[model samples]
Target: MRYLTDRKRAEGLGASKAGTEHHWYMNVSGVGLTLLIPFFVFILGTSLGAPYEEVVATLSQPFPAVIVGLTIAAGMLHFRRGAQMMIEDYWGGMTRKVMLWTVICLSYLVIAAGLYAIVRIAI
Candidate 1:
């Protein structure tokens, strides 16, 4: 029983389980964005040089629209998580909680809006 108690105390001072999970998520998102950025840049560049209808047509593709929507959602979620961590680390009092919640809510709203726009274009 004493050994278990001591182990728990030691674990408490170390990196949290949630912190590990967050790190994993952030790393995964970073890798995804690394691959996605080039594709997005190429697509945007081509679309910009094209005419207006061409732009619409390009975005109207189901696959590209879905990819864009997923990228937006993932990026927003990653940002929210990161910002929440920063707030928790640097801020104190009620302001930290408020800012964290605000960031979460705004992230969800942005993701929803992006999905709506993607669906509208795809369909």
Candidate 2:
């Protein structure tokens, strides 16, 4: 017996089970980045070209530290999802799998490194 509704069947989930989820994630992340980028830019801009100690002091403050951390995490995760969509669209077979894995790893590495640097500064 068939369990799927017409809507579900029409969504064509057999080939890609996460189309809607991926789109939703991308949208959410886009909104998050929109909200975050201005604050992030302002913080970085204020620190730009300052002496090393001043830069450290600025970033060490809780608000700037938290903003930077959140921005890094959100941006990298958004990038990962977008890159996955691109690779899936353009590449095929093992190449697609390899590219996806590479993108995922790179995105996470960037997020980890950014957060680590923020923590180092804040502490």
Candidate 3:
């Protein structure tokens, strides 16, 4: 007795392929997030109980500033990709396209804001 019907087997798990570019993007983002998370946590942990000026001063260091900026940028990209994937999965038709564009715009805005803040603190 066959478990899957011939038509079901032919469909082949819908249009989404598991081992495609989507998987690659997720894998790369996962690795980047793993590295970025620790740096972000460290920054937050060290900044705790510190005054605003002190926090700014700490970030002003070239090394810390660069690390923080890179992490923030990577994080934004990761978030954008994940959200886009989810939107595509759950939404369809014009709504899906709108949501995708919205995610893209939001991600860009977040990255821009982060970069601006980092520059202000560092410089």
Candidate 4:
């Protein structure tokens, strides 16, 4: 017979085998959003009271367009994951399932609309 400690036996029996991976993903995305937010805000803040054509021109440039696109993608993904974690922690059963689905769909919808707007501006 093989010998094993209780801790060892319980190591892989957590709620989900992918929990650690999700944790690391959340941490990394958190860091990414942290760094990107200031740059994005600066870019956006500068463009804020400009004329419509000027604002469009500013965002059409490659640098601003790329930064805004990355920020939108990262922000949405981070939001979705964070919301999922919160709902899972504070909810149970059907509520958790329906809430998770709603959050995921809403995040994707927002991301898609943001990307479409950015593309239209850039092009």
lDDT of 4 by residue, 1-123 (tens): 759975456556667766666777889999998988898999999999999999999999998888898899989998999899899899999999999999999999988998999999987
Tens-digit lDDT string for candidate 2 (31-123): 989999999999999899999999999999999999999999999999998899889889999999999999999999999999999998888
**On a 0 to 100 scale, what is the lDDT of residue 73 in model 2?**
97
Tell me how far the alpha carbon of residue 83 in candidate 2 is from the true structure, in angstroms, after superposition: 0.5
Candidate achieving higher TM-score, 2 or 3? 2
Which stretches of model 2 miss by more than 4 angstroms? 1-14
Instruction: Quote each prediction's TM-score.
Output: 0.78, 0.87, 0.78, 0.84
Better of 1 and 2 by TM-score: 2
Kindly indicate the candidate among 3 and 4 with the higher TM-score: 4
TM-score for candidate 4, residues paired by index: 0.84
Rank order (by TM-score, best first): 2, 4, 1, 3
> Please, what is the whole-model Cα lDDT of each candidate in the order they appear?
0.80, 0.91, 0.83, 0.89
Clashing residue pairs in candidate 3 (N, C-alpha, C atoms within 3 angstroms)? none
Compared with the true structure, what per-residue lDDT tens digits does model 1 show for residues 2-119? Answer: 6576444544354554655677689999899777777777766787879878887998987677667778888898899888888989998999989988999999999999889878
List runs of model 1 lying over 4 Å from the truth.
1-17, 48-51
* Model 1 score (lDDT): 0.80
